[model samples]
Target: MSRPLVIDEAEVEITAIRAQGAGGQNVNKVASAIHLRFNIAASSLPDDVKARLLASRDSRITQGGVLVLKAQRHRTQELNRLDALARLHELVQGVAQPPRARKATRPTRGSQLRRLAGKSRRAVVKAGRGRPDLS
Candidate 1:
């Protein structure tokens, strides 16, 4: 099992926004949604972790280097806020784990021979598909 991640609550900014879409009168009247924003460039994260987080292709991360997460699934404002912060913690933890470096390797002699043999077989099959010479 993975360890529980502890994110500094001070790093994230949470704002209450009206939930979008069809909620009838309740949507406009109640501010039961949350908008969580974390500035990647200005965070107190390690340099390598910050770089990795910024390089991530997550849709939540905007072009301005801000991680924006909307939490409107829950009915309560506090729940939504917690949900957004949890998501942010998950995102940070994802980048916190460093990836293993890929070792450079060359194809084995048997694999190379098999590839060349497959190519030769394909060429022969294509050559056979052409019209045969009579003369």
Candidate 2:
């Protein structure tokens, strides 16, 4: 059986705010934008995953170790809420999958020879660019 996805509900927080940009009269009145906040430090995720999530260069993650995602693309509150939650799930899942470690490698002898040959060819072409000695 496939394992269930584990997420700590306590680590996430959500709030509604007025979405900016064009929306007619309704935009000024209603707070439809969903703000989802996830605290990396307080999360129940593994240390490695937490480190990756916190170290990520995403603009959503603030300096205070909180990830803030805004979902205002959807018109309704329910859809916006779902979008925010899905984004959170995706972000967590991304960190959950660890990257494979890279093994050190060296260039092959043939590759080295090819590179040297290419450099020699380029040098000959450049050498030809010089004016012929008139003397």
Clash pairs, model 1 backbone? none
User: 1-135 in candidate 2: lDDT tens per residue?
Assistant: 324347777778989998889998888888889999889888887898889999889998999999999999978788998999998988888777778899999999999999999999999999999999999
In model 2, which regions exceed 4 Å deviation? 1-5
For candidate 1, write residues 38-135 as lDDT tens digits: 99898888788889999989898899999999999987899999889888888888878888899999999999999999999999999999999989
Please give the clash total of every predicted structure, in order: 0, 0
Provide the lowest-lDDT 10-residue window in model 2. 1-10
- Deviation of model 2 at 81, angstroms: 0.8
CA error at residue 88 for candidate 2, angstroms: 0.8
Q: What is the C-alpha lDDT of each candidate?
A: 0.88, 0.87
Q: Which parts of model 1 have CA positions greater than 4 angstroms off?
A: 1-6
- Provide the TM-score for each candidate, comma-separated: 0.86, 0.90
Candidate 1 global TM-score: 0.86
